[model samples]
Target: MANTPSAKKAARKIARRTLINKTRRSRVRTFLRKVEEAILSGDHEAARAAFKVAEPELARAAAKGVIHKNTASRKISRLSSRVKAVGAA
Candidate 1:
């Protein structure tokens, strides 16, 4: 389909960007999952640590255009509240 040289090059660039974005998204998910797991296990300290790690990853992903800024902010706020609740308990 991409017969022209420019088109072909564009396709290749798209493929490379897709792979990089996928990796970044996956890394962000992994960090979030760690926080969730720690929260579920009721380990406040671990949850806090995971939140510390995940917050930056989420912010970076948003900054890089991998996700929306508000979405990232909402996630961080909710997770922080949950972590606080765990600590209070």
Candidate 2:
């Protein structure tokens, strides 16, 4: 239904952006999942390493507008705390 040239162009841009966002989101999830797996496996060092990698990916996704800044911060905080607990346990 985007008949006008400008609207058609906008639609195309949105489609492209949607794909990019989708990929970014998937990458973030994969990183987080790695951290989770490490934590669940009770490997404190591996959890720390995975968290190190995942934290930045979450922040990058937030910076790129795939997720909110607060959400990313919260996730990083919780993951770090859990990673610490894994070491303590």
lDDT of 2 by residue, 1-89 (tens): 89999999999999999999999999999999999999999999999999999998999999999999999999999999999999999
RMSD of 1: 0.7
Scored by lDDT, model 1 comes in at 0.97
The true-versus-predicted C-alpha distance at residue 26 of model 1, in Å, is 0.4
lDDT for each candidate structure: 0.97, 0.97
**Given candidate 1, what's the lDDT at residue 18?**
96
For model 1, residues 3-86, the per-residue Cα lDDT tens digits are 999999999999999999999999999999999999999999999999999999999999999999999999999999999999
